[model samples]
Structure formats: structure tokens, C-alpha cells
Target: MRNDRQPDRPPLTTGAGWHRRRRGLAPWLLIGLYVVIGLAPLAITWLRGHPRQGLAHDLSSGLVMVGFAMMLMQFLLSGRFRDITGRVGADITILFHQLIAWTILAFVLLHPFLYAVPGLWPDPAQAVATLRGMFGSDALRSGGIAWWLLILLVPMAMWRDRLPIRYEIWRLSHGLGAAVIALAGLHHTLTVGTYSADPWLAGFWVVLAGLAVASLVHVYVLKPLRQFRHPYRLVSNREVADRIWEIQVEAERRPAINFAAGQFIWLNLGHSPFRLVEHPFSLSSTPADRPRLAVTVRESGDFTNRIGEIPVGTRAYVDGPYGTFTLARRRASGLAFFAGGVGLGPIIGLLRELVQEQYRGPVHLLYGNRVETQILYRDELEAMGKTLDFRLQLILSEPPEGWRGPAGELTPEVIDACLDGRFPKDWLYFVCGPVPMMESVEATLLARGVPARRIVSERFKYS
Candidate 1:
């Protein structure tokens, strides 16, 4: 590989440090709020004057109450709330959402089973009769509906890819199903719950259900309305590599959405934002270039494979500036980037920002791809090398005849060789890639003494 060097200029100053401090507090505050609200029903139940129940009965009631609270909280953690996801990153928030869903499912599943425990009631046959009455009762119809819906929803979500349904259809069904579950769960809680008979508990359920509905409206209605007012037009779309294309859009009669480097947007091209057709793509352009945003997408999915068909002047909607995978939040003596294939999208934006800001540090990149043709923005990356103390190491799993760059997977030996075994502990590291590759690289970095805080990564897909 050829080495290109350029004179470095002074780095630009900004209020990023102050912003980082403020944003850092948001996740903890949100978590605190979640814990308080989720446990509020239990706390209120304990305070209220209620008849004493056996341990199994009390435990069963407590499980369902907490489970319902968690179910309601799922609305806020849907990867749409910037206040909740701004600092933690959307991937982590969504991962938590999925994990928490399973937990709540388990709780709900156990609620009825525990009530049927023979030890809970003096007569085992009486407990069985009570269970049958609850299951067959007309008043508990909503509870039965919620119970079955939850049973179906979690497994369907887990095996969504294997289902014979389009992504958009699945999304629509998921949203509608969730709404039904929330409403049914709320009905059951207020009407059938022992503690919920209290005025305060009933009011709490009403408020949570209202918030849940509001969250859906915010995502499906209000957000699209706002996007309609500030739309973007496609400036250009061209193939950058074998299967990757660069999409550039210019805001219509407004400035582009302000976002830090390495952030992403939910891009909807030639479709209204109200539709569930948008896909998340990392911005491949720096904040320095406003009113014009770009994203590099690989032709992997159904929507992405049809990128070539998008007209040049199509109107676009962006719900964006999301994700915490940026340098603005962390300070470092140097920077290192490890990107694989299309994972270079966000890293490229960060590199451009470093160049634009004239960052004076030893910047290194270890970019891995399967073949040479898939390597994107080669010429521009080389130009960036000329503007900063940057080193680019291209790694290919398969190389052409007589190729001289590093070859094979991004193993520990390969990474050590690329950095010359000088892995800085304080330098910030950015990684974006396939899950296996990312897991391998992260383990290697941790083993090599890199602090976990110094390494930031964003997963491309959750499922």
C-alpha cells in the first residue's frame, strides 16, 4: 500500500465537552425513572390497606404487576426516543428491549402458574377450581387476550426472519399487536387486579396507558408530520463499489439536521415518512457539510438491492441524528478505526470530521473486506491521509495474484501486525462490522489492554 502524508492544521474547538456531560446524565436518569415507575405499583400496593394473602399469592400478584409495568415501558424503549437512546446508542436500547420482553414474558407466564400452586390455598382442589374459574370467567376476558397475545408476540418477534412475511407487514402487525396487548393488559389490571381496585393504582395504569398511546402517536403520526415540513431531495445516487452505492440528499428550503459524526438516520426515499419503509443508514458525510447528507449502503436487503431504481429527484424523509457512536462524547490522544465491508460508512464520516477539524493525532485505520472491488472511497480516503497523521491498512480475505497488502481474516495476529503492536490504552477505538468480526476484534482489543470505555462499536443489525 502507498503512504500519503499531509501537513496537519489546528483542531477546531467546539462545545462538545459540555454537551457530552449533559448527554451522559440522560441514560442514568432514564434508568432511575424506569426503576421507580416499574416498582411503583408494588410499592403502592404494600402501602395500601389490603387483606393479607399467602406468600405464593402475593408473589404471583407482584410478578404480574411488575411485568405489566415493564410491558408499558417497552413503548419508550422502541429505539425512537432520542432522550432515552441519545447516550446509550439505539442498538443497546433495542437489545435491552428484546431481552426485557423475554423477562416480562417469563413473569407473565409464571403469574398464573404460581396462583395454581397447591401450597397457596388450604385446599389443593380449591386452588384448581379457582384457576378454572379465572380462566373461564367473562370478566377476565381481557386478561386472557393479553396473556395469549404476549405468548404469541415474543416468539414471533424472536423468529421474525423465518416467517413468511415482509418486513413492513411484520412491523405493522407488531405495532398493532402491541397496542392491543397494552389496552387489554390495562383493562385486566384495573378491572381484575386486587391492588388495582385502589384509586391510585388505577390512576397509575391510566397514565401509563396514555403515555404508551402517545408514544405510538409520536412515532407514527407527529414525527411524520414534522418530517413533511422539512423534507430532503435526492441530489445524486451512484454506485461506489461492486454492491455499495452512495446516496446524497439536500434539504429542501432548510438546513440539514445537525448530527455528530458517526451518527445515523432512518432514511425513507420516495416514500412518506408515515409509511414503515425507512431503513437506518449511517451518515457518511460530516457535520461540517450541512444541507447535504450522504449514506453509503450495501445491496444486501430487499430495499437496499433496489437502490439503483431510485430516481435522482425523489423526495426523501429523514428521522435522524441518532446513535452514540461518535467521537464528540469521548476525548482521546489518538484514534483507531476497524471497519469491515460496508461498516466503513460511519467510520468514513468520522475520518472526514477529523480531517475537517484538523485533528492532530496519530490516526490509524484497519479496513477489512472480502475482495478489492468492495473497498469503498479509496481515492477519498487516500486524500484524507494527505490531510492528517493518518495510516490506512487495507486487509483483504482474498487477494488477487501478486497482491502485497495484509491478507486473511482480522485475527489477533493481523490486528497486532497492522498497528505494529502499539495498541494505545487511552486512544479511542471505533469498530463497525459483522457480529462475528466485531466480537473477535473486541475480545482481542480487551486482551491487548485496551480499556472497554475506549472502544465504541455500533451493531448494524439486531436480529
Candidate 2:
């Protein structure tokens, strides 16, 4: 690693907005809002002052409203809202969306069960009769529809990969099913809910449902129309590694999206953005690369398999420069990166940014792959070591004969060996890889006394 250090020209802390401490308030604020709205129905119900409907019955109604509120709120947490997602990361928002789905499921399943709770005493037969009577009622038909749809909807989303369905097909079914569920649930609430008779409570449900519909319109209609007006042209797409393609696109017009390195976009190519056809990909070119945006993707998934076939000059729609995994908000004396396989894309882009900025601090990278052929931009990374005080350690879990460098999985020992000895615990770290590997590395960092706030990462897929 060479270090002909020059006077500091670009400060890492220049964009104070990215400061983790500054942005920390957003997640709490969002969580507070979620709690308030989720409980708003219960609050209104209590205030409306209904006669005693028994504790179990009142509890069941409360659960139904909160669950429905959460369902509607799901539209806002769909990773498409920048104002919310900017402070609360896209990954966190999406994961929360998935998590809250299960909670909603619990509430829906328990609502009817709780209604029959009083009869489940000395004789179990009474509970069964209570449930049968409730199910037989014509007024509860909409509730039944929403309940059944929800039962199918949540599991479908959770095990989507295991089921033999295309992503687009699953997505279409998901959206349609959710809409029906919301509408039916709204109908049930407004028509049969004990508290629904109160005008304020009914109006609250209407407002939430309308917002839910507006969110759908914003994503499927409004945003796409905006993208259509400001499209990008595919300038080049070529193979960069074994089954890995690097795509570069230039703004069709004059304005290109400005983003920090390591940020990503939901890329819709050739296909109209109105269709649920886009995929999330990290931007692999430096922010300095301007109107020309680039992404490196592996040959996996339905759409990526044909990445090589996309001809130049094809139109593209980009939905973001999202994610908060960059130096823009962080302050550190040195930097460390851990990337696995295709994870090298954003890490390489960050390195490029550092080189472009002529960063003087020491930088270290640990990139792991199963074989040498899986490595992307081998020569380029080596060349980067010459420009900045950069050290790169290539860890191969399955290396070929005569391999000289460290070769194995990224264990604690391997990490310790690559640390350059002088790097301190406070140096900012970035990790990108398969979920298991990323988790292992993150745990290792935390165990080694790295502050949680000092480690930055982004995940598009969550279990």
C-alpha cells in the first residue's frame, strides 16, 4: 500500500446529514408514529363510550382495529417512500413490513377465537357452538373473506421462493390479494363493528383506507409516470466476471440522479416501470461517474439471466439512489471493507470514490469467494492498492493448487490477519455478502469491540 499523502482536500464529514447520530431520530419518530396510529383506533373506541360488551368482546374488537390499522400502514413501509426510508433504512423498513405481517396474522386469527372465549369454560362444546354461530352469520361474511385471504396472503409472501411461482406472478397476486383484504376488512369494520356506528371511528377507517389506496397509486402509477419523463439509456452492458454482468446507463436527457457510493436503485429496463418488473441493484460506479450509472449483477434470478442480451440504447427507469451505507455520514481515521462474491460491487464502488477523492487514510479490504474465477475486477483492485493506502486480502474458501495467499472462509483468524495491525477498533467497517456471512462478520466485529454504530451495511433480502 502506497501513501504519498497529500494535504486533505475532501473531508469525510462534509455531509453532516449522513451522521448516524443525526439520522437516528428518524427511526424512533417513525416507530412513535406507528404506535400512535396503530393504537388510535383503540383510543377512539374507548372515548366513543360504548356499553359493556364484556371484556373479551371489547378486547377482540380492539385487536381487530389495531390489526387493520397495521395492515394499512404496510403500504407506507414498502421501501418506496424516501422521506420515511431515508432516515429509517430501506432494509429496516422492508424487514419491519415482513415482521408486522406475522403480527397482523396473529391478530386476525385471534379475533374470532377471542369472541368465543367466554364459552370455553367448564364445557368446551359451548365455545364450538359460539364460533359456529358467528361463522354462520351473513353480516360476518366480509370479515370471513378478509380473514381467509389474510391467512393465505401472509404465508404466500413468507415462503414465496419455495412455491413454484415467478416473482412477478407472486407480486401480482400479493398486491391484488392485499387490496381485496383491505377493502373487505374495511367493509366489515364499517358495517358490523360495534364501534363503527360512531361517525368518528368510521371516518378514521375511511381515511386510513384512502391513504392505503393513495400509496398504491403513488407506486404503481405516479412514480412510473415521473420516471417515464426522466428515463435513462443503456450505454453499455458487458460481462465483468464469470456469470456477472456490469451495466452502465446514461441519462436519456440531462439530469442524472445524484447519490453516494454504495447506494442502490430499483432498475426497470426496457419494461415500463408501471409493471412490477424492476429489481433492486447497488450502484457499482462511483458517484463521481455522474449521469452514467452502473450496476454489477450476477447471473441469477429470472431477469438477470438475460442481462447480456439487453442491447445498448434501451430505455431504463431508475427509482432511487437509496440506502445509507456510505462515508457521507461516517467519520473515521481509517476504513475497512468485507465483501463476499457479488458483494464486491458496492465495495469496489466505494473504493473508487475514495480514490477519486484522494483519501489519505489507510483502507483495507477482505473479499471472499469460493474460487478465483468468482473474483471480479482482480487487476483493478490491485491497481487501487497503488493509488491509496489500501490493503486487499483475498480469501478463497476453495482455492486451486499452489495458491499462495490465505485461503479459507472468513473466520476470525483470517480477519485478524488482514487488519494491517495499525488499524484501530474505532475505524468504520462495511460488510456486504450473503446473509449468513454478513451476520458472522458483523458478530465478529461486535465481539472485537467495534461500536455497532461504526459498522454500516445494507440488505435487500431478508428471511
Candidate 3:
């Protein structure tokens, strides 16, 4: 019998499981809260019959700024910032984040009209006149500019694909725009009345300003300073299969951070966090060896495609040891790994960890690629299998001529064949891949009597 205990992975312990009941439905809950919060100001305005005479006058701007901050925090917590935080994958997490962003935009559109307009809201001309009228006065100029900048930037960012800009460049520009908007907002707060005058509102602004500054420091100064103190020089960079690169780094520090098998880190390649362009790669090294680390990365996306160009001997910043997608905490009669495409990064890391730990448990590796040419770390996996006590099975979806391994997709029959009826049903399974492959593999596994609890899958979706 396999041990079914699930100790929470340390990296994922910071409030990740706290919202378990509200995971998928968190957006709806946030929406309900948003509606309530928005309505508070409107209700105040309704009772007072004037904009400046109620709590809404004090709370509206603060609410807007704080709400924006909350939504951004949601993005960070949703795992979209997984590269920096090293938490979970940004799969479904990003979906919730997007929902939050859209919700904020909707509120932003409605906020001004409820307080500024007189029964002419939802009317295009009146809303335009209300916004345009603010720009006429010197006192309201900063607020008008801030509001315009936010309105322009948010929509441009929401429809980034239509914009004539590359993702990497757009990311930098978007960050700059946010800084401008924030600065303008600060100027407006200083010049405006109500919320800007109250000590509590003033304190809230100070705290928000501090948070922004701290986040900047965390990404730039603190993380980089730590890296400088514990220098990790790049030792080897090999071009693995499917144009993926395996980077081996040697840490000079005495007590380097230890990570479990199948974890990942955010690599800051000469770009400051202020630039908003760091990338995440899965650690392909074992945890037993603490002074060194390795990560295999596929050359996809704007940031990842530049990995091939990263010169060796260049210093890199690593912020991680995150992700709960490892095989460390589970006990199973047998272990199975299902990897698709570049999803092999974590699997390779886990295998190396298993070898270092000298795990005698029966383990299996089922990897899939489009073709033989796209199979990454093939020779390395072959060598590792020879030395380690684990079975290896390669599946090619689009195998060319002269291929001898299993062909076609990873169906239930292929899984049964690989496990040799020793699957033990209670065994833990780790799966990593694109959405469709993961769904198919999960469905097939469930059908074959594998309990949902026995399956640990990480889906990596691009936003």
C-alpha cells in the first residue's frame, strides 16, 4: 500500500492552500466583493444627493487605487508571476488573474460616472464631457492626466496582440506607462480634497507607495545583492534536443539554497526586475547537491528564444526553489512521470534527484515529443537510466523513419504497457504538459482506476 500523506511543499505554503475551496471560483467571489465595494460609494452618493458630501468622497479614490493594488496582487498570487515567486505554474492561475483585470476595468469605467455625472451616466457624450471638463482646471489636471493614462494603457495592454509591438518590448513600455500613471496619481492625491486630506487616506497612500518601492527593491536590489554574495558562475551550456538548452551552474557560496526534485527558478538574465522581462526555467539538477544547479529550457517565447544567445561566463540571478510539482512528498509502490514536449524539464530534474537520493523504488519515465528530433536530453536520459534504477519509455507522436520505440500518442494502452500491470493503482503520478495532452492523460489515467488523489499534474499555459 502506498502512503497517502501529502505534506504541503514549503514553497507553496504562503497562502496557496488557504483558498482551496475558492480556487476555480475565486474570480466570481472577487466579483461579488467588487460589486459590493463599488456599490458602497454609489450608495453614499445616493443618500447624500451630492458627490462631495458623503463617505464616497473620501473613499472613492482610495478604493480605486487599493482595488488596483489588490488586482495586481491577485496576478502575483495567481502564479502568473511564478517566475519571480516560484510558486505553481501559471495555468488556470492566469485565467483568474485576467478575470480580475477585466473586473477592475469595468469598475474603472463606472466609478467616475457614479460620482461625477448627474443622471447622464451610460451616455457617451456626458461621460466624455465629464472627463474632458476635468482637464480645464489646473487643480484637476493631474487627476485628469492620471485617469487618461490609466484608461489608455489598460486597453492597449488588454489588446496587446493588436498593438504594433513585440511582447518583450511591450512589457517594458507597459511598465513605464504604469510608473507614469502611478506618479500622476500621486500628484493628484496631493492636490485633491477629501481622501487626500484624511490622515487614514494619507497613510494608505504611504503604505501603497512603500509596497511599490519594496517590490522594486525585492526584484532589483535584494535579489541581485544575494546573488552577488553567493556567486554562481555558469559552468556548462549544452544545446539539448528540440533546441532546448541545458545550463549547469556552479554556486561558490558555502550554503546554497536547496530545492527538491522537479522544482524551478526564475532566471534574471542581465535584465532588472524593473524591466519586467525575467523568465522561468525548470531546475534539472538534483537537490542532494546543493552547491550547484541546472535548468533545462526550451527556446520558445520572446524571452526564452534568447537563451541561445546568452553568452557563457555571464552572471545570472536566480530567484526560486519554488513549485510543489515534485515527487518528494509522496509514497507510492511505483512512480510514473508523463512529460510532453518541453515539459520534460521537471521530469529530468526529478530523475536526477531520484538518482542522487538512491531511491530503490520502481519508477517509470514516459516522455512524448512531436518527433525524434524534438526529443530533449535524449543521450543524458539514456545515460542516467543506465546508472539509475528506473525504467525509461519514449513515445513519439510524430516519429519519422528508422524509429524503434513506441509510436503514436500516449493512450491508455501505452501506459499499461509501460507499467507492466505493476501500476499499483495507489501509485502517485506526476504529469506535466500542454493543456490537451494533460487532459487526455488525466482522463485516461482516471479511467484506468488511478485515483484523482494519486495524480499530480502541472499544466503550463502561456497568457
lDDT of prediction 1: 0.87
Candidate 2 regions exceeding 4 Å error are 1-25, 121-126, 420-423
Q: Scored by Cα lDDT, where does model 2 land?
A: 0.85
Q: What C-alpha lDDT, on a 0 to 100 scale, does residue 307 get in candidate 1? A: 97
Best by lDDT: 1
Tell me the whole-model lDDT of each prediction, alpha carbons only. 0.87, 0.85, 0.64
Better of 2 and 3 by lDDT: 2
**Cα-based TM-score, every candidate:** 0.94, 0.93, 0.74
In model 2, the clashing pairs are 18-329
The all-Cα superposition gives candidate 1 an RMSD in Å to the true structure of 4.2
* Clashing residue pair totals per candidate (backbone < 3 A): 0, 1, 0
Weakest lDDT window of 10 consecutive positions for candidate 2: 1-10
**Runs with alpha carbons beyond 4 Å of true place in candidate 1:** 1-25, 118-126
Ranking by lDDT: 1, 2, 3
Clashing pairs in 3: none
TM-score of 2: 0.93
- Residue-level lDDT tens digits of model 2 in 322-379: 7877776557767899999999888888888888777767789999999999999999
1-463: candidate 3 lDDT, tens digit per residue: 2454332332221221112221122445645654554354334434545445444434555456555444334423335343432333344455555556666665545556545545254676875676567657788777677677767876777788888888768766665666566667666765673445555545545565555546544655676676666666676777877688888777666565667667667676655444455566777777665677888888777767777777777666676666667664345555789999888888877777666555555678899888898887778788776655578899998888888889977888888888775555656788987778888889988888888878877655545
